[model samples]
Target chain A: MDRTEQERLITENRRKRELRYIATFVLMAVIFAVIVVLNINTGSVKISVPEIFRVIFLRQGDKVKYDIIWSIRLPRIAMAAILGGALSLSGFLLQTFFSNPITGPFILGISSGAKMCVALSLIYYIQRFGHSSSVIMILAAFVGALLSTGFVLLLSRKIRNMSILLVGGIMVSYICSAVTDFIVTFADDSNIVNLHGWSLGSFAGSTWTDFYTALAIIGVCAVVTFLAAKPISAFQLGENYAQSMGVNIRLFRVMLILLSSVLSATVTAYAGPISFVGIAVPHLVKRSLNTAKPIIVIPATFLGGAVFCMFCDLIARTAFSPTEMNISTVTSIFGAPVVIAMILKRNGGVKQ
Target chain B: MSEYVSASGLTVGYNGRPLIRDIALSIRRGEIVTLIGPNGSGKSTILKTLTRHLAAIGGTVTIDSEDLSGITYKELAKKMAVLLTDRTRPELMTCRDVVAMGRYPYTGSLGLLTEEDQKLISDAMVMVNVLELSDRDFQNLSDGQRQRVLLARAICQEPQVIVLDEPTSFLDIRYKIELFGILKKMAIERNTTVIMSLHEIDLAEKISDKILCVKGDHIEHFGTPEEIFSTGLIGTLYDISPKAFNPLLGSVEMPAPSGEPHTFVISACGSGIPVFRALQKAGKPFAAGILYENDVDWQVAFSLAAEVVTEKPFEEISDEAMRRARELIDACEEVILCPVPVGSVNARLRELINYARNAKPCREA
Candidate 1:
C-alpha cells in the first residue's frame, strides 16, 4: 500500500524465496550424499562404510572390495547421477521451450528416437566390427534425438495446442519403439543379449570411460544452459514476450532444441531410454523450490534429478538383488505418480 | 513535442503475406494512440510489426528518427516494451517476480536485479497500485490484478514506447478505467508513448489522443478522437447500424422496436430515457416528442424511439415540433407523461400533455 510497506513486502518475498532455494538445495545435497553412500554400501558384495571410504579416498583396501568400489559401483553411481541430472535438465529445457510441464525427451519421443537409432547402430556395428563404441552410439543417438526433436518442432508449428503436440509425440514414440523392436527381433544372438538389455533401459555396464564422456558432454550443456537462464526466464512468459525482452527467438529456439536433444541423447546413449525422470524430476524440484526461476530451477533440477535417479538406481540394484530390475522400472514406479498428480493439479487449478 | 514514433506506408501480416498495407502514422511524444477495428482486422498484426514480434512485410517504422529494423533487439528493448494478448501462466512466480522480468534488458547475464532495478520495480508496481499484490502468486491473481501486474511489468521496462495488444480484453469496466488512468499518467508524466488496440471504442474515444481505424486491407482513418468520432466512422468501422451508436454520447443502444407506434411519451431533461427503454424492451414501437437536440434524453430517444419530434437546444418548443407531437399523440393508442421540469422556455409541453390527456388513455411514468 504505502512505499515502506511495499518495499518491506517485496523484500520479505525475496528473502522467503532465498530461504526456499537454500532449503531445497540443501535437502537435495543431503539426499544425494545418502544415496551415493547407500549405492556404494548395499551392492551384492557387502562392503562396510569404513572400507568403502578407504577404497574411495585412501585408495587402499582388499583387492576384490577395491575393484568393486572403484570399477563397478563408483562409475555406475557417477553415471546415474550425471545422466539423471542431464535427463532432468533436458526435460526442464523442453518444458520451458514448449511452456508445458508434461513435455520431456521421453514424452516427446526424443529418447525413443535415440533408442531406435542406437539399436540400429548397435546391431550394425556389432555385426561389422564385433562391438559398438560409446562414441558411435552417442553420435547415432544424437542424430536420432535431433530427428525426433525436428519432427516434434514441426508438429508444434502446425499444432498450437500442447495436448495435441504431446499426442503427436506419443505417436512418434510408438513408431520409433516399433522400429527398435523390429531391429532387436532379428539381431544376432550376442547382439540381442546386449540390445535387449540396453533397450529395456539400465545404468549397468557403465565404465569410467562412459562416465567421463557423459560428464564432458553434459557438463558443457549444463553450463551453457545456466548461462542462458536469463533468456529461458523470459521465455517462460511466452515466445512473444521473450522476443520483446530482446531475446532472438529464432536463435534461442535453436539453442533450446539442440541443447535438450544433446542432453537427452547422452542419457539415452549410455543409460538407454529412461522414462519419467525428465518430466518428474523437474516438476518435483520446482514444486520443492516453490519457484520456476531458471537460475534456481536449473541447478536445483540437476541436483534433484541426481538424487532421484541415484536412489532409483540403488533400488534397482538392491531391490531384487542379483536379478537387477531395469532402471526404467524403478524410475517409472516413482516418477509416474508425480506426473499424474501434476496433471490432476493442473486440470483442477485451470478449472478454478 | 515532435513525432517520437512514425510509420509510413507500413505493411504488416504473418509469414510474408500482407493483411494490412500502407498504414501511415505519426504520433508525438507523450501521446496515447488506440487502434479500433472488428475481429481479425489486423490490429494485432500492426502492433506485432511495431513491436518487432513479426517482421514488416513492407515499408518502415522509425523511433526517434532511427529506422526500426536497424536497431538490435536489445537496443530496441530499452526503447520499447509490450504487453501481449497471450496469457502467460508462469509457474510458482509471485507478482513481484513477474514484474522483475521487465528489467531483462537492464539486468546482467543472470538477470539479478540491482538495488536501482529493485526500486524501479517497486515504483512500477506502486504506479499501477499492485504493490500490495506483490506477494501474491501471479497465476492466482484475478484477471484485473494480472493485467495490472503485467502493466507494471511493462512500465518497469522504462521504455520510450509501450505497445499493448488489446490490453483491456479480459478486464472489467472498473479495471479498464484504472488501467487507462495509469497509462494516461505515464504518457503525460513520463513521456511514454502508448500504442494499444481496444475493443471498447467508448473508452478508446475518451483516452486516446489519436485513433487509428483499421479495416479491410488498409487504415480506414487515422486522426484525433475528435476527428474520428465526430464523423460517425465507428459505426461503419464495426459494421453496426449507424443509429445504434451515438457518436455524441459515445454509447451504443439496442435496435429500436419495429412496427407502428402504439404509445407516445412526453418528457424532457433526461427524464424520458427510462420510459423509452421500457417501451423498447416491451417490443412495442413508441414515439417520443418535443425534446431538444442537445439534451441527454434526445440521445437515447434518437437510438431507441421509432420516431422523435426534436427541437434545438435552449429554445422554446417550436410550433412545428408541437404540431408533430400532437399528431403523434393522436395516432398512438395511449400516452405516458414523464416527470419533466416546467421551465418557462419550453413550457408549451404542458399544452401537449393536456392535449395528449384529452385524446388518449394517458398515464404518468
Candidate 2:
C-alpha cells in the first residue's frame, strides 16, 4: 500500500520480463553466427566470410568455392545443427517425461537400437542387397527404436520406480550392444571397416538429402511438442496432478516418449551416437533461462543444441586437422565433465 | 437403492494374498465413520480398496448402486476423493497451484482454469483457513499447514465423499481441532460422507458418528460411538486393563487400589499427553493420589491419567496429593515421578506429595 513498495514491485516485474527477452535474443543471435562462421571457416577448404555469404545467398562465387560451399560444407553444417537441435530437444522431452533429470533420449537404448540396425545393415543385409541398404537401415532402426521404447514404457508401468526404470533401459542398451557385437564378429573385413566408421558418428558423410530429411522430421516433431507444452508442465507437478488436470496421462506419456525416441533414433541413424550434447545442452539451456517452462526452455534447447554441436564439430575437425576426431570424442571431453559435476552436486540435493 | 457406499463380499490383497477377506460394509451420508485398529490391521487396505486404488479379489463395490469398476475415473473423482498418507511432491509448487489440481477432472482438454474453478479453489482454501498462505510454496509450509493445504486440495475436488488416511498425524492440537471441525462442517452442510483412520482412539471416540472397530482379522464391531463406547469396545481394542477410570468427565485412567499409596500425576488434559511417554521412558511406577470430579485432567487421571482416589467438585482436592503420596509410599518400594502443571485448582499436588516423603536414610538427593 505504500508508494515505495508499490514502485518496487512494478520495477521487479518489468526487470524479470526484460531480462528473459534479452537473454533469448542474445542466444538466438549467437547461435546464428556460430553456425555460419564455424561451418564456413573450419572445413578442409576454407572460404572468405563474404564469399561464403555470397555463395549462400547471391550464388556469385567461383566454381571451387561454390562447390565447397554448396556441395559439402553447407550440408554438413546443416546436418550438425539439425541433429544437435533434435537431440537436445528430445533430451529435454525425455527428462520431463520420466520426471528424472538423468533421463536422456539415448538413456532408454534408442541409440543402441539404431546402432544395432546400422551395424546389421552394413554387415549382413547390405552385403546381400548391395547399395540398397540406407532404406533398409532406416526402417530397421525405426523398428528397433520403437521396440526399445515399448519395452521401456512397459517396464515403467510395472516398476513404478524411476531408478529401476533407468536401470532397465541401461540393461536393454547393453543387450543390444552385445547382439551388435556378435553380428560384427562374422562380417568381412571391408564391411567391418565401414561399420566401424559409421559407428563413430560423423557430419563428414552428410549430403543435402540428409539435411532435408532431418530437417523435416525435426520440424514436425518440434511443432507437435510445442503444442503439448502445457500438458508437459502439468506433468512436472506429478501424474496424479496431471490426471486431475484433465490430462490423459497414458496418452500424453506415450506420445512424449514416442516423439523423443523417434527424434533421437533418426538422428542416431544419421550421425552415430553423438554424446552429451543431448544430455548436457538441455541443462545448460534450463540454467540460462532460469525457468523450465517448456514454452521458453524448448526453443532455447533447440538453439543451444545447434550452437553446441557446430562448435563441437569445429573442435573435432581442427583439433588434429587431416585426422578428424569422432564428434562424440570432442563432446564427451567437454560434456562428460559437466555431467559429472552435476551428479556430484546432486548428491546433497533433492532428487526428482 | 443404497444410500451408502458399500462393498459386498470384498476381498483385497496384493499378489494373491488377501489382506482383508470376504468383508461387507457400508458408509452412509453425513456420518464421520472412523476405522480404528492397530498397524497392519487392514485399515488402509480397506480405504484403498474403497477408492479403487486396489481391486478386490472377490467382491463388488458400489456407490449409489453404480458398480465401481464401471464408473469412469472422472465420475469417481466427483463422488469421492482419497488422500493417501504420503505427502511428498517433486515440484515446489504453490499451495494454490496444488489446490487447483483438484479441479482437473472438470477442466477441458486444454486444462485451463475456469473462473468457477478458481472460485472453488479459493473457497476450499478459506474453508481450511489457508487462504492467506496460498501463495507460499507447499513444501515450505509446516506439517500442519501442509496438511490443511492437502485437505483443501481434496475439498476443491468437491467430491460427495471424503476419505483420509491419518489426516491428523502431523497436526498439533489446534490444527487437529480445526481439521476435525472442517470435516464435521462438510458432513453437516454438504451431506458428504466422511471416513478417516486414526491412532487417537479417544479423540476419534469423541468426534466420530460411527466407529468401525477392527481387531484380530475382521470387523470386530460397527455401530454408534455411544453403543460402542458403552460396550467398552475401545478398552479391549487397545488392551488397556479395566482398572482405567475417569473420576471426572467419564474419561479413562488407570486407578490404583484405594489404600495403596502412589505418586499420582496431578496433570490435566493436554498435560498428560507426554506423561505416559515419560513414564514409559523412565520406567517409573506412579499412581493417582487424588483426582477431581470434573477436572479436565481427570481424563488424564481417570483413564491412564494415573492411579488415583476419586474426589468431588473436581477442582478441590478430596485428599491432598500429600495424603495420597503417603499411601503411595506404603504400596511402592520406591517412587520416581514428575509433576504436571494442570491448572491453578490443584497446582499444589506436586509440593504436597513431595512433603509427604522424608529423606531416605541411604538415598542421595
Candidate 3:
C-alpha cells in the first residue's frame, strides 16, 4: 500500500478501537448507576425511589429508612463495588504475572490461602488474644497469600503445562479449605454464629471503618497498578521483551506479586474469600473493550468488576430475601459460566 | 569502517559455566555479521550472552567503546535492541502497540508514546512492510508477520546495533529475503550494525560482511563470508562430511549415490544437475563425462557420479578423457544424454554419444 493509503488505514482502525473503548466505558458507567440505585431501592423496605435519593443526597426521609440506607445498604454496596474491583484487578495482575489466561486469585488458590490464614487468626489468635482490627487480618492474609504463591511458583518450575499447574492450585485450595473447616468445626460456639456466615463469604454487615480501611488499601494499590500499566503492557509481550524494553524484570515481578497479594488480601480480610470474580470480570471487560492495553483495561476492568460484584451482591441478599446466599454461591452462579465460555471460546479459537 | 561492537574472551553458557569459551569477535559499523553453526552448538548461547539475556561467564563486550556491563540497562537499551525467539502471545495488543513498545527507552516513565515516538513506530513498521497490519491483533498474526512486526519493534528502538537470534526461523522464503533486504538497508543507509544468528547458510553467506562460525569449545573461524566459505569451514562447524557442502555454491547436498555405475550420462553446462539428482533418487549410480572442467555440470557430475571422466576447468576435453567415458558407457546399463550445447572444446562428448547409440543396448529394465 502507498504511504497515504497506509496512514488512512491506520487512523481508521485506531478510530474504531477508540470507539469500542468509549462504548465499553459508557456501558460500565450505566451499569454502575443502575446497580447502585437497585441495591438501595429494592431491599424489602420498598421506599420510593425519590425517598432513597433524598436519604442519600439530602439526608432527609423516614428515620428507619435513613438508618437502614445509611448504615446497612450503603456500606454493603460500597464494599461490594470496591472489593469486587480489587479482586478482579488482583486476578488481572496475577494472570499477567503468570502469563496464563486462566490465572486468578480464586482459580489459583490465593483467596483460599488467605481464607485459611484469616480463619486461623480468627479461631486461634482472636479467640485468645481478643478481637483484632482489619489491618491485622489483612497482614495475616497477605502472608498466607505469599506462602501459597511461593508454593505455586515452585510447582510452576516443575510443571510447564498450565492445566496440571491449575490442578495443583486446586489441590492447595482443597487442603486449605479442609483445614479451615476443621478449625471452624471445633471453634467456640458463640463466635461460630458470627464467623460461619463470614467464612462462607458475604458483603453484608461490613462496618464503615472496615470499608474505609479497604478503600484506603485498594485505592492506593489500584493507582500504583494503573501507573505501572507501561511495564504491564511490556510484560504481556513476555519477559524478554519487557526486559529488553528496560523493564527490570526481577523487580517488576516482585512488585506484581506483592501488589496482587495486597489486593486479594484486602478482599479476604473484609469480605471473606469470593470466587470467580477475579477471572470472570477481567475476561469480560477485555472482551467487551476488545483491547488489553493496560492503560485502558486497568480502569475498565475495575469498573467491570464493580458492576459484576454489585449485581452478584444484590442477588446474594435478595435471591431468597431475608435468607442470604453466600457471596461465593452467588458469584459462582454468575461467574463460572463466563469462565467456562471463555475457556471454550479460547480453545475453539486455537483450533480454528 | 570503524569497529562498532567488539567482544573478547566472551565465555558463555548456562548457569555460570562455559559452554563455548574464548570467543573473540569485532564487528565494524554498518556491517551485517551472522553467526552460523549446527543446532545446540552454542549459536543461541553466544547471541543470548551478547544481548545480556543470558549472562556471559567471562570477558567483556564493548559497544561504541563502552563496556557493556558498565552501562546501565536503561542506557544500554537506548544503544542496543534485540529480537529473541520469544513466543509472546500478548492479549489483544495491536500490531502497532507491539511495534510502539520499541519506544520504551525514549518514552516517559509511563511509556506513553509521544508524537515523535509515534512517527518512528510508523516509519519502522513501514520499513518492514507491516504498516497495513498496524491495528490488527498481534496474537492473530502469522509467524512471518509477527517476525516482521518484531523487527519493526527493534527498528523503532533507534539503537546503534541490533541483535537477533534465529530471526528467520519461522519465515518463508519471501519473508526471509525481505528480512535480509531490511537488514542490508539498515547496515548501509542507516549505518546500523547488525549481529544475528542465521540457520540459512546460503543466506548467511550472501548477506554477511563478517561471519562467526560457532561450534565445540571455542570460536572455529571468524572472517568475511568469502574467507569463511573458501576454507571448507562450514562442513567442520556442522560436523558433516566435507563433500556434503559445496562451498562454491554456498549450499549443502546429500551424500551421493554410491556403488558401481548403473547409467552413463552424457551432459555438460547446467543440464546434468537435474539428471544427476534423478539418478541419485532412483538409487542408481551414474557415470558422467567428456565435458570441459569449467562447465557447471562438472560440480554435480563429480558429486553424484560413481565415476566422472573430466578435464580441468578451461581445459580441452582430452582424448584420454573420451576413452574413459567410452569405457564407462560400456559398463553402464543405460545412458541418458542431457541437452547441452556442443562447442569446439566439448566436441568429443558428441563422439561418446555416437558410441552409446551403436554399442550393445544395455538399458535397465
Q: Which candidate's DockQ is highest?
A: 1
DockQ of each: 0.80, 0.19, 0.66
Candidate 3 lDDT by residue in tens digits, B31-138 = 899999988889989888877788789988888899887877788889889999988899888899999999988888778887788789999998999998888899
**What is the per-candidate TM-score for chain B?**
0.97, 0.73, 0.96
Arranged by lDDT with the best first, the candidates are 1, 3, 2
Best by TM-score: 1
List iRMS (one decimal) for every candidate.
Answer: 0.9, 5.2, 1.0
* lDDT of candidate 2 over A1-352, digit per residue (tens): 4434533553465367559757775967676796667678666787888887788889887999898888887888888888889889988888888777677857778778778877876676658865544456666677777877788888987998887898898898888889888887888877877777778888787899878877887899988888787787667766655554445677888899778877887787888877777778888777666556576677778888888888898788878988999898998898888777767766656555
Model 2 score (lDDT): 0.73
TM-score of chain B of 3: 0.96
lDDT of 2 by residue, B1-365 (tens): 13668878888777668877777778778888998987888888888777766677888998867898788766887778766686555344567767776776777654577878877887898788787775566767888888888889889888888889889988998898998998999998988888889987777777898888877567778787788777767658766665453312444553433433333443444454465445534545556445555545455544443365666664555455456555655555544344445456666665554554552211111
lDDT of each: 0.92, 0.73, 0.87
- Clashing pairs in model 3, backbone N/Cα/C closer than 3 A: B333-B362
Error of 3 at A74 (Å): 1.4
Off by over 4 Å in 1: none
Per-residue error for B182 in candidate 3, Å, reads 0.5
What is every candidate's alpha-carbon RMSD to the true fold?
Answer: 1.8, 6.4, 2.1
- lDDT string for model 1 (A256-341, tens) is 99999999999999989999999999999988888899999999999988999999999999999989999999999999999999
